[model samples]
Every structure is written in structure tokens, then in C-alpha cells.
Target chain A: DAGITQSPRYKITETGRQVTLMCHQTWSHSYMFWYRQDLGHGLRLIYYSAAADITDKGEVSDGYVVSRSKTENFPLTLESATRSQTSVYFCASTITRYTGELFFGEGSRLTVL
Target chain B: AQTVTQSQPEMSVQEAETVTLSCTYDTSESDYYLFWYKQPPSRQMILVIRQEAYKQQNATENRFSVNFQKAAKSFSLKISDSQLGDAAMYFCACMNYGGSQGNLIFGKGTKLSVKP
Candidate 1:
């Protein structure tokens, strides 16, 4: 794809199982982010990476883990998936840290069983 | 911490008419940004329009426009000549430069429905 893409658009996993959502961007942007969308909360940032090997935590980064080994890849891992973790996950990228406009992927719908 | 709030959970507009989605935010910092995002049935977040806090002029893009009131912390989106394609979940988000840069705090969102 020419733009950002998320793998496993639809995922279902059991409780206590480990699952990872993948994000890849072709724009070679400097910043990448992961956000979870729920009914009442809208979209909350989980984790973000400023550049390769540089990452930071957002508002809801308690149970989530993220890494940016490469500029084009930023993956979010749920060590122990729970029912509450079932939500639509979106990966976004921007050229600048603060002022740049964001570009989001289609989103990965994860269902916890 | 900055917080964005979209009071309206849903809004409906007749085709060819105009509709406005309201959004309010709370922040201590003076410098920041406001944005409106659209997520259709496909679940893809698309940037509708953006308004900078420092700019006094409202931002307009085609049929979309924003009324940014910095003093009241209100940023409302107005869509003119509404069409069926405009039906989607519209989200209001705020990014604070005082803290993290790329991190965005979003409101609950308003689902806009266009009736033909």
C-alpha cells in the first residue's frame, strides 16, 4: 500500500492471551501513534514513537506496550488481553511532532473472547 | 491535562441543508491546536479541518468550516450543503504543545446523520 496499513484488520483472541497489532507507514513520517477507540471514550492515545527507537507513553498506556525498531513500523502489544481491551485500534502518523496533520489507517477491530 | 468535549452525541441534517457540531475543550496552556476528524462506516479517521489557537480567523475547507472561540474554549464544525456522504462520526481533538506534541486528546464524538 502507498499509505499506512494495519495488519489483521479483524482479530479475536482469548483472555490472558498475548496479541499484537501491527502498523506500517510508507510516508516515512517522524511520528507514529496508537489509539484505541471505544464507545464513550472516543479515541485515547495508547503509545507513540517520535522516531526509530524513541517512544513515549500517552494517556492510556498502562497495559499496552509499543516499540519502533524501524521508522516504518510501530506495533502495539497486549501482553494479557482482557475483555475491556476489545476496541478499534487505529495507527496514525505525522511529519511533525505537534503541528503536523495526522493521517490514520483504516483501523484494526480487536475482539476479546 | 487538556480535555475535549463534544456535548452532542448525534446530529441530523437534511440533504442540502447545514448542520453544526459543537465541541468544547478545557486547557491550561495558551498554545495548542484543535482539529475535527471524520470516521465513516469504514472506520477510517479522516482529518476534516484544523484551527490554530493563535489564528483569529476561522478555517474553512470547501463545504466544511470551523468556528473557533479561544476564550470560551469552543470549537464547532459547520457543514454546508450536506450530502449523504457527510454522515459519519465526527470527533473533536486537542493537542497541547505545552506538553507532548503529537499526542491528541479527543472528545466523545458526534455521529452526524444526513437525511435525503
Candidate 2:
């Protein structure tokens, strides 16, 4: 495909368990981002990567870890999942780090119990 | 920190009619970017339109257009000849300039319903 894709569209995990959300983009964008969407909060950024091996924390980065080993893949990991983490996660990518449009994935709905 | 505000939590418009969704933002920077994104039940964030702060003219794309009032810091989206397909959650986002990296700050979003 020519767009961004997220794996495991629906995931259910137990509290304290580790879960990883995978994000892949075919455009090879330099900037990749992870955001969690919830009711009343809209979307909050968790993490973003400028390029391979360069990543930074966003507005809501606690409990979530992200790594970008390659330009096409940026994965987010939850070391110890909590019930509060249950929400729809979105992955986005842009061709430029300055001024560019963002292409989003279908999203991953993670339910923690 | 820059913040985006979408005042209308929900709105409804009849098919083939025009509807405008309001958005306001707070930022001290003179140069920046604004955007309107649509998310349907499929949960895909699609860019509907974008506007540059420095530009005086509004940006339009097909049936979608924006009313950008830089002095008031307001950016409203106007959808002409609304269709059922336009029903979705619309979010307004802001991005500041002069930063080494670009990250969007989004509003709570407004849910638009197109009635037949």
C-alpha cells in the first residue's frame, strides 16, 4: 500500500502486561507521530520521531515508549499497560519536519482491563 | 504554549445546505499554520483544509473553505452543499513556526451531522 498502516486494529491487554503498537509508512516520511484519542480529549500526542534514531516526547508521553530504528517504521510500546491507557491510538507521518501535511493510519483500539 | 479551541461541540446541517464550524486559537507567534481535519466513524484523520497565517486570502478545496481572521485568531470551516458523507468529527489544529520540529496542537473537535 502507499499509505500509513497500523497493526492489530483491535487489541485487548491485561493491566501490567506489555503491548506494542506498530506503525509503518510507505512514503518514507521524515516525521512520524503517535497520538491517543479519547472522548472529551480529542487527540493528544504521545511521541514523535524526526528521523531514524531521533525521537522526542510529546504532550502525553508518560508510560508510553517509542523508537524509530528506520524511517518507515515507528513503534510505540507500553511497558506496563494500565486501564487508563485504554483508548484509540493513531499513527501519523509527514514528508517534511517543518511545514507538511500529515497522513494518518486507520488507528488501533487498545482496551486494557 | 499554543492552544486550539473549537467552541461548537456539535452541529447539524441539512443536505445541500451550507454549514460553518467555528474554531479559535491562542498563540503569541505571528507565523504559524492552521488546519482542519475530519475523522469519520472509520477513525481516519483526513486533512480537509489548511491556511497560512501570513496569507490574507482564505484557503479552499473543492466544497471545503476556510474563513481565516488573523486578528481575531479565528479559523472557521465552511462546507457548501453538505452531504451525508460530511458527517464526522472535525478538529482544528495549530502549529507554531520557528521550531526545529513541527507538532500540531488540536482542539476538542466539533461533531458535524448532515441531515437528509
Candidate 3:
């Protein structure tokens, strides 16, 4: 795809299981982000990477882990998925951090039991 | 910490009419950014419009325009000649440069319905 793409558009896993959501962007943007969308909370940033190997935590990064080994790839992993982790995950990228314009993926809906 | 609030949880408007979605934010940073994003049924987030806090002029893009009030910390989106395709969940977000530049604080969102 020419734009950002997310893998496993729909996923279902049990509690205590490990799950990974992959994000790939063709734009090679410097900024990549992971956000979770819930009912009342529009979308909360889980993690963001300024560049490869440079990552930072967001508001809700307690149970999430992110790694950016390559500029085009940023994956989010939940070592031990819990019921509270059930939500739609979105991956976004932007060329510049100043403008705040983001291009998001189609989103991966994960359901944890 | 910055917070974005969209007071209208749900709004309905007739096709070809105009509708305004209200958003308010609280931020300590003097210079920041405000944005409106649209999420359709496909769950893809699309940027509708953006406004810089330092700019006094409101931003207008086609049928979409934003009224940015820095003093009151209000950023409202007005969609003119609303169409059926405009029906979606609209989210307002804020990003401060003093903090993580790319990190955005999003509001609860307003689900807009267009009646044809």
C-alpha cells in the first residue's frame, strides 16, 4: 500500500496471552504513534517514536510496549493482554511534529477475554 | 497536562444544512495546535482541519471551517452544506509544542448524523 497499513485488522485473544499489532508506513515519516480508541475516551496515545530507536511513552502506556527497529515499521506489543486492553488500536504517522497533522491506519480491533 | 473536551456527544442535522461541533481545550502552553479529525464507519481517522494557536485568523477548508478562540480556549468546527457522507464521529485534539510535539490530546468526540 502507498499509505500506512495495519496488520490483523481484527484480532481476538484471551487474557494472559501476548498479542502484537504491526504498523507500516510507506511515507517514511519521522513521527509514528500508537493510540487506543475506547468508548468515552476518543483516542489516547499509547506510544510514539520520533525516529528509529527513539521512542517515548504517552498518557496510557502502562501495559503497552513499542519498538521501532526500522523507520517504516512500528509495532505495539501487549505482553499480557487483559480485558481492559480490548479496544481499537490505531497507528498514525506524520512528516513533522510541529504541524500536528497525522495520517492514520484503518485501525485494528482487538478483543480480549 | 492538556485536555480536550467535546461537549456535544451526538448531533443530528438535515442534509444541505449547516452544523457546528463544539470543542474546548485546557492547556498551559502558550503556543499549541488544534485539530479536528473525522472517523467514519471504516474506522480511519482523517484530518478535517487544523488551526495554530498563534494565528488569529480562523482556518477554512472548503465546506469546513473552525472558529478558534484562544482566550476562551474554544475550537469549534462548522460544516456547511452537510452531506450524508459527513455523518461520522468527529474528534477534537490538541498538541502542545512545549511537551511531546507529536503527542495529541483528544476529546471524547461527537457522533454526527446527517438526515437525508
Candidate 4:
């Protein structure tokens, strides 16, 4: 109840439909990151936010849009989901950018049909 | 850019036995941090153990210990008295402290199976 949580633990969407994964953390960590895990590739960072209104691209950010309006919430949206985008998305939070351990959520499993 | 590599894609250990998972990294910076994370079927990334590069001593947490060779740039995890709960994917990660921001660069991961 007091940790990072991702909504819609399991989701199925059409290839062209829009989908958004919500991530919320109660720790109020300054750094929030979104990563996609797939076979062979492992975990690849999609986007990261240093603080409110401050976000940066990661290894794979294409087709993914992230916004951090509030420190507790960081949402990742896919404008048009694709079959290639089907993977497990994880949300993590860190108290500081200098040195801190990351706390991950349960993960959101997305299946694009 | 720092790169972490886990040579063994999968490994199996009998219950109550010991097993070691190998991890190697390439980095120019001397000061950094290394971590081992376990992702079970639940998909929650849990920090198993961590080692600071500056510390010459290895880091250990109960049944989990790291054999960190600074010179070789190798960090392998040894799990003793393995249990069925130990069955999961373990990932080795590296974080460079010399950089402006310390972001973790993770390896592909090694899946460990605990056999009865």
C-alpha cells in the first residue's frame, strides 16, 4: 500500500489503439524510470524523469510518450500500439539521482493483438 | 558507455547445493557500484546484494554473496544452499559514479533453476 504500484497489471489492446500505463509511487522519489523488458533484449529504459516536468529519453523511447506532472505519478502512453511493443513494462523510483537504490513495481504486461 | 554481460543464459542448481552465476562488465571509470537483482515470476525486481567498487571486500547478504574482482572487471554471484524460492532470473547491473547521473546499466540476466 505504500510502495510503487502500476495499474492495469494485465492489458490487451489492438495494434492501432492507444494505451497508457500508470505508475504511482508513495515514496515521492525524485527519479522515476520506465523500462520495457523483452526476450533477448532484457530490460531497456524507455524514459526517465529527474523531477517534475523534467524528463529524458532512454535507450528505447520511440513510440512511447511519458509525462511527470506530479512527482508521485509518471504515466507512459503509447500513441499507437504495435505488435513489437508488446512486452512487460516496469516502473521504478529512486530517492535521488546521485546515489540511491531503485524500487520497482509489479510490472504491467501488455499484449498487442 | 558501460556494458554489463552475463555469460550464462541459464543455470540450474540442486536444492541445498551451491551455484555461481558469472557477470562481467566493461568500464573505464574506477569508481562505481554493482548490483544483483532477482526477478521472480511475480516480476518484481528485488535487490539481492550490492557492492561498492571502492570497497575491496565482497558484499554478502545471507545466502547470497558476490565475488567482485576489480582488476578483472568481473562480478559473479554465489548462492549457497539454494532453495526452490531461488528459482528466478538474476541480473547484474553497473552504475558509474563518475558520471553526472548514476544510471544502472543492466546485463541480459541469468535464469537460475533450483532442482529438487
Q: Per-residue lDDT tens digits of candidate 1, residues A4-109?
A: 9999899999999999999999999989999999998899989888899999888889889998999999999999999999999999999886774789999999
On TM-score, who's better, 2 or 4? 2
Summarize candidate 4's per-residue lDDT along A68-113 as a digit string, tens digits.
9999999999999999999999999988765647899999999999
Model 1 TM-score, all chains together:
0.97
lDDT of 4 at A49: 90
Error of 4 at B74 (Å): 0.3
In terms of DockQ, which candidate is strongest?
3
Query: For residues A7-48, what per-residue lDDT tens digits would candidate 2 score against the true structure?
Result: 989999999999999999999899999999999998999999
DockQ of 4: 0.61
Give a tens-digit lDDT track for model 1, residues B38-59.
9999999999998889999999
Off by over 4 Å in 2: none
TM-score to native of every candidate shown: 0.97, 0.98, 0.98, 0.97
Overlapping backbone residue pairs in candidate 3 total 0
lDDT per residue for candidate 2 within B30-81, as digits (tens), equals: 9999999999999999999999899999999999999999999999999999
DockQ of each: 0.71, 0.68, 0.77, 0.61
Q: Higher DockQ: candidate 1 or 2?
A: 1
Candidate 4 lands at a TM-score of: 0.97
Query: Under CAPRI classification, how is model 3 graded?
Result: medium
Pull out the clashing pairs in model 1: none
